[model samples]
Target: MKCPKCNSEIQTENINIQADIAQCNKCKNIFKISENIEDVIDDNFIVNNKPNGTWYKSDFNKTIIGASTRSPIAFFLVPFMLVWSGGSLGGIYGSQITNGEFNLLLTLAGIPFIIGSIFFWSLALMAIWGKVEVSLDNKGGKVFTGISTIGITKHFLWSDVSSIKEGQANLRYPGGKGVSLVLEGAKRISFGSSLKEERRYYLLRAVKSVMNKNR
Candidate 1:
């Protein structure tokens, strides 16, 4: 198969069946090759230069911009969880208000449900229409998240960041893996929490490469 980055022919000698690693003759990019490399190549199963809306690069420099690739599982799970949790919260809170009894334990127990409901709903919203833009450049890195034309932003200097690594996402059951930036003092900023495993791996590599280059 041709190298995805350079579009050059791959060398047979550089490809090892046992290790499943292939070094592109042109780009020198070492990548994992599935056992069915010929079939995958024929089917165009190689990672695309541009992975839809999840990743991009700037013209000035290799500034990597990553966004969450919406998950199909989130499409189904989020709304159901939202409705269930919201109903439970409403019922419990309403019952307490009507009875004029404030039970601390019940309230505490309900807090998790309430939080879970909001969190999952947010993931659903993100999967449908929400977007988080993560950019890494020579100066530092930035994260922006919001709906189209509206969002929140955060920026961190290179000095402020310790590293970037893969982490488990909050939206666990069906989809919950993501990559996170480890800030100087143990703080973390996570993104791509709903992406598939392959996408997450590519993203983690990109983030790590950029972070390493800058450092």
Candidate 2:
């Protein structure tokens, strides 16, 4: 195999189960191989191809980074639990209201479940309808919320990005890790809100390195 970016001879440097990480000696382009190479390698070729992620070179020296959209386990589990708990609590509350037993404590207790239902439903809908991506170049980086018209209509270039910080995103019930880009003017924008801890750290390092190189 030849490196897609530099045309250098590709060699298998590491293997694990059905996937192997291949590296190019000339340009140091790395690719993840999961199946027979002959079929996967098309005319356009590719640079990096992780199972649920992507790292590739694009037109005009742009580097694209893709993270997993939704967790496979959370996709079904979250919605199910949200609907179940919301429905059960909502039904009980309704019953209490009818029986003249409604109280502040019950309403307060049900608020969390109602909020969870709304958030999980929104997340599931977004995953089903669109995808998220990040694009970076010599100038700056852009975080795209999703691909639909209603998804991420506007994107701002963070030219003053000084560093990227990693932390937990506690927006939803079972929040995951996130990465935030700290800018020069004390401005911050976060991405990878749904990524795992390790994946978020990896993205943070990758974006930080690219930003440093551009600087």
Candidate 3:
């Protein structure tokens, strides 16, 4: 096949192979080759059949995170702190009533703790659901979080991606094993966990194929 980006001929020779990736000496682009190649590549094409856009879409079949699993120990502490602050206020109020001395200063002391607890809870909830969607298309690529799309910061033509890096790392949560893609421009993207090693390798091959064809 012809290289999609440079119009160079793509020659394949099998070398040391990993579960998910292979090295191509011709144009030197490592990509993923999987069942989802069609879905990841953009449909739009130029007169020469080259992809025209900069975005790629990847749909993960596995669960990223669920509400049940995402709820950390800190989540339950919010209510506890609020209740404790309320109890402190009650204690101060009762002491003032019996002593005939109104201690307004002591009652206000719990306000900061209550506010801080609420803020912590809010942040934890946000972190639990936030996930990055890694995708590729004719336009190029994107990482999506909710309604926001984060574009790949490094600029490289599809021809420039040379290698794929695969490894595992502990993620913050939601996802466990990490899969990474190292492109020619030193741009890298990773996903998955140890539980999905097979899927991760498949994804690596699919990306390698795409990058090779593009380059």
Candidate 4:
């Protein structure tokens, strides 16, 4: 097999009865042979080393729950409905005051404002429930946020990742949530917390594992 780090030929040396470490003879690098290599490796039984720099692929299908799911109702729908109802009520009041004829200029001005509110509200709703897809490749990765089936994709180099920290913290936007991940420097580019605790632990471990192997 080829060494993931340097694309050199990897040779396995038996370390114990049940374990063997794959070492790259050229680069003098070693990585633990994972038991789940079948799922992790590509069609050729080599790790998925795509053009982008990610050693693994993780797709998060986050269910819209809590406040993030309700933000449309609270921030957009409620306010728009209230404003529209108020405008209708105002038009009726103005018509009554003007002896059965509504003021055309007042009603016309309100119409545009109401329409603009609807547009703005729809955009806000779109922003709330948007599905964000984050892809990490060999070069880099990106967070794609939108309602369309295809999510956004971003690319970054391995060197661009300054640091990887692991911990639990409450997240914003969706709110009332805690997440864990191998953070890249100060920027929170992707959602790491969605992974199961064990999976997340391994993900963080994998980041450190690759980093140590590269170093």
Tens-place lDDT digits, model 1, residues 9-93? 7777887868888888876888778732432242122235446656656556647556664768665866787678768987879
The number of the candidate with the highest TM-score is 1
Ordered by TM-score, highest first, the candidates read 1, 2, 4, 3
Candidate 4 per-residue C-alpha lDDT over 82-119 given as tens digits, one digit per residue, 9 for 90 to 100: 67756664565556676876676766666766676665
Candidate 3, residues 50-88: lDDT per residue as tens digits?
A: 122212333342111111113343355446655765566
Off by over 4 Å in 3: 1-132, 145-160, 168-170, 178-184, 191-198
Give the best candidate by lDDT. Answer: 1
The predicted structure with the larger TM-score, 1 or 4, is 1
What is each predicted model's overall lDDT from 0 to 1?
A: 0.64, 0.56, 0.42, 0.45
lDDT of 4 at 166: 63
Best first by lDDT, ranked: 1, 2, 4, 3
Off by over 4 Å in 1: 1-48, 61-64, 93-110, 145-154, 160-173, 177-191, 212-215
Of models 2 and 4, which has the larger TM-score? 2
lDDT of 4 at 66: 12
Residue 192 displacement (Å), model 2: 1.3
lDDT by residue (53-133, candidate 2, tens digit) is: 434445667876655555564577566866786676768687787788868777888887777666666676654444456
